[model samples]
Target chain A: MLCYRAWVETRWRFLICLTVMLLPSVLYFHELGIFPMQHWTSDPHYAYGLLFGTHLPSIGIWTFAAVFLGLGGLLRERAVGTSTLTLTLPVSRAHVVGTRVGVGASETVALALAPWIVNSSISLFERTPFSRAQAGWCVLLLVGGGLVYFACAVLVSSVVEGEYTAAALMFALVYGIGYLADHVSGFSALNLYPLMSGTRYLDRNTNLFPGPMPWLGILASSSASALMLLAAVTITRRRDF
Target chain B: MIAAPAIQTSSLSKYYGRTSAVQNLDLVVEANRITGFLGRNGAGKSTTIKMLLGLIRPTGGDGTILGRQITNPELNRQARAHIAYVAEDKPLYRYLTVAQTVRFAAAFYRDWRCDVAGKLLREYELPLNRRVKALSKGMRTKLALLLALARKPELLILDEPTEGLDPVMIEHLMQTIVARAAEGTAVFFSSHQIAEVERVADQVCILDRGCLVLDRSLDSLRESFRRVDMVFPVDVVEREFQLPGVERIRANRRQMSVLTSANAEGVIERARAFNAVSLEVAPVGLRDVFLAMVNGLESAIGKEN
Candidate 1:
């Protein structure tokens, strides 16, 4: 039931993000080709890299939506005078926060998959070879890597009371990281832009595995997300309604 | 076996930095009775209620509801299954329709009564599909009440339940409280409305500046508290009348008025010893007792400053 309430509160934002990414992918594929047509079929690595780059914006958009989903806890409820009613229910604070986080995370994963679904549909209709493994890797990397921003949103919403302030702070942090990653080589691996470090194109001509995956960066991002989520839950548990 | 207290607190305090919101409030509300928690605005009435429900953590002390420790989150959640609370604002989800609101609340507990909910929905004339934000204040209040009453909770706590209610609604609300108590549900309500408190509350607890000033059964208050007015030919110092049982003493020239909460007879007998020309004793009403308790504290604080 709490999940239902969370969905009711967040479905519009999720749908908007999904539509924002889905329509653009379909349209981009439908329109006249900007790059050569042979690039898509002759070199699968270049095609995958191009696809990954085009869908990078979707990660940022999903992060925005996830932030909004995380902003519906006691502070927001108190503004509407419903916090008392909510807290009085026979449910623990952990359950309420857990349900909201779970719902928001689920929506985030689904949003991450929207572009892949659109690309796969286009590939099938056009009779072009689509790598299931590459598509699966894209979805996995986007979700796993993009969770850092989602967790940042949850942590900000847990602490900050005003909606605009929390959102603004989250955007600043995300954009600030983007700016730092572009300027500094050391932070490039941590850059969530370009979607999964823009790998799958180490050699543009061939799709062969010579270098190992960026396991350290992936591990760092996943751990950061978990830490931020745990912080949010701890803060919420200690708070008064 | 004697029934246990529906609610009990020991030194329950909430402090906001240097200021105290509620201070060492030791209170007991017995089972199967309507107890009115009376206080002036900002007298910690709402704070105490919030603490009892575990909506907020206490800064210093703790309480229990239905024998479950309120400070423990798990225990409080367990206790809440049997508690129904209506906040002062009568809050409901404005985005949900009235019917959906009812359905949402009913899904939480195993003891929800659809029959009572249906009866209240009809009597209130609440449009099932009408959004909560579109409803009038009175209708919103009724919807909140319906949600609470339909559960038939073991304890019902309302804060300022009749604050903006009309006379008819107030009367109906009072009757509902009495009916709930008759069904063996302990009702604890906080209000500034003394008349309603006197009419419905079996016991009254008055708080002032985070401290309890009075806690007694209404019948005992009526029997003990008295207003004794006296006229003296010669002027008498205020300290002369500060004997036992004297709560507040007001003096103007040769006129002296005294309010006493206990041993009224003894206080009056001493007044005669001062060679009073005339003396009058009147029974203390709840309003007068409440005013004296609150005003007396104000004057004391005023003198300190």
Candidate 2:
């Protein structure tokens, strides 16, 4: 029932994100009939060099969705006058926090996988040659390099009060880090965007990640995500509701 | 075996930097009885409840619920299995239907009584499919009460349980509270309604400014508390009215009114010696006691300062 409660609390956000993320993929390209025309076959690389030719800028959209998915928990419930009900439950705070995060992270993975797969099926229906391996790598890279954003949002929401306040701070923090990664040499290591979207490995001629994957980057990013989630749980457990 | 007190706190205090929310409160609420926790707004009643439930940590002292340590998270979590609480706001998930909220709450406790929940559902006439956010305030309070009462816990903690209820429903709820206590469930509720508390609570604890000023059984209070009205000659020193049981003495030139918790007869004897023109002793009700304890305490502090 904890899982059920978490799902009920966040089901709308998940569905809305799924609908919005798939909107451009389902309607935007198909309406223009770009897939039926010769704009793709003549060039070696796809239009705008979209990752794997079917991602729909999958990393950026999924990161935003992840942050939205992580917007609520005990602290956010505190702001909304529901934390008392939650705290009065017989379960440990850790169990409640874990269940919420587990549901959200599962939704995050679904966000990453479902959209790209649907896009790949659309590519097949349109007679385009989108590689399944390329789609798989896009998912691996997106999840491995992108879950930290979800974890970051969770930590911020766990400690901060007010939903809009926490969301604004999360966006500022994410975009600020993105800006730093672009300009500052010291922050180049923080540039998760390129890794998640696989822009660096994108073949200018093929728009595909053709070589070996970044195992070190994935390990490091996944570790950071784990650490951030642990921090969120600790904050939830130690702090007053 | 004798059961431990449903709640026990020793010097339990919560301080926020320089501000004290709850200060040095030592309270014990035993099982199988109704204990009304009375206080005005911001008197630290809610804060004390939160600390006892492990929703917030106590900064200065230690406490226990059902004999388990409140400071120990694991022990407190274990203790909550037998404790049911309804918050002052009746905080239910807005996204969930009334049925879903009840179902979700039932899943957490081993003591959940489905028969009672079903009975309450019909009694309260709560729409099972209606979202809680769409329910009326009175309906929301009913739903919250249903959730707590259905738990059949060893201890039931309710904060402002009767707020936003109709008279009929409040009456039914009062009967239900008494029935629950008769069935061996201890009830500790906080409310501003002194009349309701007087009707239902076996014992009353009045809190003011985070301090517990009065804790006594209702029978004892009725027997011992009194208001003495007297008119003495002019120029009688107020200090002469001092006695062990005199709680407060109000003087207006010659006429004096004395409130006493005990020794009302002794106060009357002194009044006779002072050549009182008129004197009358009346039983003090719970409302007067609460007001004098809370507002009168403020006046006492003012006079001392």
Candidate 3:
């Protein structure tokens, strides 16, 4: 019930942002007639594919959502003083942190999925010849990215006292990694920068031309996310509420 | 007499760097009694409550709630199952409505009394749909109290539960706490308001500067401590004035008030030798006892120095 209430309060803002995010992609597709020219030979089709492919990494976007959503969970409670309510309950600290993380992960998933569902529905009307396999991969990347971001956000919220500071740190880490990945080659592994680069991967579909599945990138993102969540739970448990 | 206290502390202490918040304090709260934990601000009342609830660790010594050792996680967890707490700040989720907040709290406790909670909300005239952030301070305190009371736990620890509440709300809270105590729930709460303590408390524990100054049943405290007001014929110099059983003495040229922990008659007899013109013995309440004990402790220290 706590999780559901939190989701209801936050879902509207999330959807609004998601809608605004899809606008640029929709306009780009319409202006270039990417839908009408399905043939690989046409510039629009290739351009559209490249655009979607470049944004395929999902790691960065998911990370940003993770952090953003995690902040909402941890910091909101602290802000409202509801954290005391949770602490006084006859439950363990682990249960409290776990429930919050689960709720956050679920919200991130819904947020990530909403965009894919909306884009897919719109594509049906536009007659865009986008690959279903690519769409599925995009969703996977989003989930993975969301998990990593959620973990990082939770970790930051646990350690930082104020909500704004936690949010700023999350933004810096997410975009900082993305900026580094764009300028430096080997550093692309750190590009799980939550917001800017995760969606950018889906925008360009860079995953299709990638060598070796970017296993190193996937591992780094997932490991960082898991480690952060673990740290958050541990810290919360030991804290004096 | 052999049964363990509902709440017990042995040499419990908390230190924040060089400063000690509560130092080597020992206290025991027996079952089926409302213990009024009284202290001035920064006197370690909140710190002591926090340590008792295991919200914070004690730097030294240990405590037990419902017979479980403070450090035993499993025991603490089990012991907490029988306890409920209302924080001093009355903090709740601001975004959630009152009903939603209650529902959220209900999820954690197995023995939560929803009927009681509903009754409290209605009786307290609290709006169910109002978000916690929108509620007034008194309303928030009521809701926090309602949540704690609805659990019907064996022990309830409240930290300054009535601090910001208006008179009527404070009275209602006292009634509710008294009612809860009647049902055999051990109530341990801290407040600076002496009148409230005098009204409902069965036992009173007075703390000053992280030390336990007075711990006695309210009735016994009143019975044992006496306030003797005396008017003297002449001025009494500091060192020359000595009275039997007088723990503390405050005197002016023509008037003197002596606080005697024992032998009030003996003190009065000694006061007669000083050519006292008038003498009156008044029954002491928690406030008088508190002032007397605190002042006496200070004076005793001063004399030693």
Candidate 4:
């Protein structure tokens, strides 16, 4: 846990990006004149409501934070030669890698739920209905996206040798997948940007408007994440360091 | 008669793609002795140490470290716990303070001696609060040794632990190694500092170009190899000064320094026949032995070429 905290303190870019991710939702509520008091509800002008309404885009924030933070955690130690010290410990390599991944995932989950909790609390005073299941599902999808992104970051860190090169490669991957998903119809399944867009079954009646539910995309992403994690563990176990 | 050797390798070989880094390495590090692994740059010292620690997979043969199989990961981990390794580069976490690094190392070993760590920090006068990156090269090496020593391991594998330090620090490091060996911890370290090794190590292994050229006890080494200093008469011819069993001979004016592999008797006989005025045969130390071996290898290679 101290390792995680130390990493977060050193990695200011990750903190800045996380702040930027939350800014849109916070500003959306403020723009609608319901930030401190009422929560953003379904408005007559916009069918999809504001970004922080029942259809808040928490998954996007979660995925971005997870990928950025996860890569930083895994790569910074190696870049600074701390991984050599970490590996020399009596603990198994798997345990060290798992602890780092677990801490990164935890941070992603916490960041994902921040806006939801704030909105839910304010909705109580604003006389707007808050569905606990809808928020929970949103958090779950964000976690799933985070898990996938975290696994991808771990794999990238293992394969790339240098710090700057690995980070550049990760950025390229995130943006490349997102750009392709937006333009190509078939590639959206691979895009991690719109994590909860496929889960329409859970948000039918609520003010939240879910997009086309692609079950195959969720299944594929989950499987890829599992495989990436397995590969990372294998590489770590067999590595010479 | 003797306790089982703490570390033994037989016909161990490791290859990096097409090049062989360590070939047919045979070594036996006995219990309760300080062994110095002496070698020139790229002499396979680091490669052999890595194989002994099971860090790199050996291409041929195997060895036992602390009575455990080398290839087995679980046993390797267990064996590693009993032995402490300080790498050649003295690599450490730059972001962590000295105290944090010590604590981090303590978290792994079951028998971590925090008291020893504390004592060493005080004894060495290390700044525990300073970040490792802020430390000087010598300080980093001390902290690395401190981390390894705090584990109370039975065997300590140090690779060039004192490569770049002042004479005072080198002497202090040698004293610390001697103190540790006195406590019954077997210390095996590599160094190019022959005088330092001669001061503390009982056993010496000399490596040259990925081969173990010389391995012997320091006492036996001194007895067998001798440096004979002789002053030939001014009338004696230089060509007539050549003697059998002489490994190396260097002369200036009337004095000739002959490094002989034979005992003092043979060197004396040759010196007398050459009409030498004065002859002194001094016992050879690691420095003499190392120079002889390296020069011998270079000459042999020169001849081959």
Candidate 5:
């Protein structure tokens, strides 16, 4: 029921993110007439890249969603007038944070899969071939890297007091860090924009399918997400309701 | 056998930077009784309760609730499992319906009593399907009480339980508290309402400016505390009546009023020694005792500042 509570609290934003993430893929399939062209003529590799690249908008929307989802835990429950009730529960603060983070991260993974699911349906309907392995890899990379933003947004939301302030601060921090990663050669691996969209890795080889996955980037981004969540838990534990 | 106190705090102090909220407080609340925590606004009643529940960490000192140390998070969680707390505002999830809120709260505690929950659901006439935000203030209070009472916890702590409640609702809530106490649940509730506290509380602890000024049983307080008003033919020196039990002494020309919490007979003898023309000793009610203690503390604090 805790999970249900978290979902009910976040379901609206999740729906918004799902719609925003899947619309472009659905629209692109209809506009390009890629269905009739078939797999051999249409170049599924480039089509896959374009469809997945549209993930940038989804990622942007998801960063806000992640922060908003994470906004109402112990730290912000004060604004909602439920902090005392939440804090007094038998569960530890860490468990409360864990449930919230788990629910939110799951929603983020679902958002990452939105494009894949949409594209796959279109491919199946058109008898246009799609690589399950490539689609899985895209989801893996996007969620792995995108979760860093989600976790970072969680961290910011945990610390900042106001809702809009936390969201604005999360956006500024994400884009500010992205701006640095874009300009600095040493920080290229840290850029969330292309990392979430699969565009940065695609620059080297257009064929993301049957191609070597960005395992190093995935490992690095996933580690960062873990670290941010740990920090959030620590902050929550030390906080006095 | 004397069981361990349901709650004990020694030198438990909470200081927010420069201001001290609760200072060097030693409190022991016995089990199987309704203990009323009475204080004026911002008198550290809620803060003390928060510290006891580990909702807030104490800056200094320690406490134990149901023999579990409150400072340790793990231990506090263990204590909270058997402790039902209704906060001052009686906060509930606004997004959840009354039934959903009950279900969500019941999931966390192992001792949740479904029978009591169902009974309260009907007794309060709370709309099970109505969202918490949609409930009236009275219904919300009832719902919060229902959640706590349903737990049948070993210890129940409620802050300002009857605040903003109608007289009938307050009476019903007091009855429920008394019923819980009768069932051997050690209930600690804070309130500014003296009459309700006097009616239901077996033990009363009064807090003034974050310090406990009076801790006594209601019956004992009524028996031992007294108001002696004497009309003397001559003015009496205030220092002459400075007895061990004298809590306050006020002289207005020939008439002198003395309040004391103990040794009332000694006070009467002292008044007679001063050749009091007319002497009347009255039993101090809980309301007057509370006012005298808190008002006396306020005056002393005022003088020092």
Candidate 6:
């Protein structure tokens, strides 16, 4: 029932994010030639373009959508004057927070998977089909490496009070991290953007990930996400409102 | 075996740094009774309610509802299963229709009464298809209240339930409160409506500046509180009638008014000794008692009336 409430509150945002990611995927897939997003060259690198592919544009959009999904809960409920109705329900605060995170994370997973799922289904019908293993690996990389942003969002919203403030603060925080990772010179192995897009493991000659998937990078981001969510739970469990 | 008090607290206090919200508040509301919680604005009535429901953690002390510890999350959650609360603002999801709102609330509690839900829908004239945000303030208030009244909880708490209600709705709500109590729900409500509290409450607790200054049964308050008006030939000072039970004294020329929580007979005896030409004694109404109690602390509070 709580899941229903959570879903009802978030379904629109989830659907909007899904559509944003899904529409571009189909556009990029069926376009006359790859790399048509920018300028087309005489000798097209189809495999290389598909490697970075539709998932590249969606990474940034999904990150923001994930953040928006995590931007509401009891603290935001306080701003909206519904904290009493929510908190007084015959359920634990942990249960409330858990249900929201569960729904949001599930939606995040679906958004991450939707584009690739459709593209992979389309690939099966093409004259020259793409590797399903590569798409599966891409999804695994996206979910495992990108969930920290969503969790970071949950933490930010839990700690902050208003929607716009939490959103602004989350953007600034993520932007700052991205800037530091880019400029700091030595943090590339742990760089979340590279991890999320699978750029670090990709090969230009054939396709991305000539070796194996970046399992360690996934582990690192997933751990950070877990820690942030844990902190959020603790803060919310003891918060006055 | 004895049933626990529906609500109990031991020095339950809430403090925001230097400022205090509820100070050393030891409150005990008996089971199967309606206790009207009265307080001036910022008297910590809502803060205390929030603490009791675990919406906020207490800064100090501890309390319980239905014998479950309020500070313990699991116990508080269990206690809420049998507690129905309507907040002062009467909040509801703007996106849901009245029927969806009812359905949302029903999903949380097993003891939800559909009969009362239907009856209130008819009585309050709430349109099931209307979204909460689209409803008028009065209608939304009714819907927020209906969600709680529909539940057959062991304890029912409402903060300032009649604040924005019209006279007709106020009368209906008062009756519902009484009816809920009659059905064995221990109801603790805060209201600025002294008349409504007088009509429905078995126990009246008045909070002043984060302190529980008054807690008494309605019968006892009616029996004991008195105001004695006296006329004296000689000039009299305010201190002339500082009797033990005398709570406040207002004097003007030869006329002296004395308010007492108890010992009205003693005040009358003292008034006679002062050689008063005429004396009139009247039982103090709840309004008068509230005024005298708050007035004793600050003259400005009485001016707000």
Residues forming the 10-long window of minimal summed lDDT in candidate 3 chain B = B296-305
- Each model's DockQ score: 0.80, 0.85, 0.47, 0.33, 0.82, 0.83
Candidate of highest TM-score: 6
lDDT of 3 by residue, B1-305 (tens): 56569999999998889899898899999998999999878989988887877777888999889999876656787888889999888877777788888888888788799899888888889999999889988888888888888888999999898887888888888988999899989999888788988899999998888889778898877776777777877887644445555667776667767777668887778778877899888776677677666656334223322
Every model's TM-score? 0.92, 0.93, 0.84, 0.82, 0.93, 0.93
Judge candidate 2 against the unseen true structure and give its global Cα lDDT, from 0 to 1: 0.87
Top-lDDT candidate index: 2
Q: Local error of candidate 2 at A66, Å? A: 1.1
What is the per-residue lDDT of model 6 for residues A1-241, given as tens digits with 9 covering 90 to 100?
7898889899899888888878766775666344342343333346436635787888888888888788788888888888889999999888889999999999999988888777766655443345666677777888898998899999999999884788899989888888878888786554677777887677766564676777887888899999999899899999987
Q: Which stretches of candidate 6 lie over 4 Å from their true place?
A: A32-52, A185-190, B252-254, B297-305
Q: Model 4, B1-305: lDDT tens per residue?
A: 77678788888888778898778888888888999999889888987887777556788878888888776667777887878889888888777788877877777677689898898899777898999899998889889888887777888888888876667777877887898888888999998878888889999998887778888898888777877777877744445545665666666678767666665677688679878899887776577668768775233223212
Give the CAPRI rating of model 2.
Answer: high
Tell me which residue pairs clash in candidate 6: A202-A208
Candidate 3 lDDT, A1-241, residue by residue in tens: 6556656656765665455555545654564464344553344345446445434433444445556668854444666566666666676777767877787787677765665565566556565545555655555666664577678778888888764888888788777776888898899655544332344344343333232234456666678888988898888767765
- Candidate 3 chain A: 10-residue stretch with minimal lDDT: A205-214
Give the TM-score of chain B in candidate 6. 0.93
lDDT of each: 0.82, 0.87, 0.73, 0.71, 0.82, 0.85
Alpha-carbon shift of residue A39 in model 4 (angstroms): 9.4
**Rank order (by DockQ, best first):** 2, 6, 5, 1, 3, 4
Model 4 residue A50 lDDT score: 41
Error of 2 at B7 (Å): 0.8
Docking category for candidate 6? high
The positional error of residue B222 in candidate 6, measured at the CA in angstroms, is 0.8
Per-residue lDDT tens digits of candidate 4, residues A1-241? 3454346344574566557556655664555463433233444223223432433455655566677766744345667655555555555667767776666666666677776676566546454556565566566666664578778887888777776777789878988888888898999666665565434443444445353344565677778888997888778777665
lDDT of 2 by residue, B139-238 (tens): 9999999988987789999999999999999999999999999999999999988899999999999888999989999999999999888887765777
Tell me the tens digit of each residue's lDDT in model 2 across A89-199.
Answer: 888999989999999999999988887777666666765556677778888888999999999999999888995889999999989998999998899999887788776
What root-mean-square deviation over C-alphas does model 6 reach? 3.3
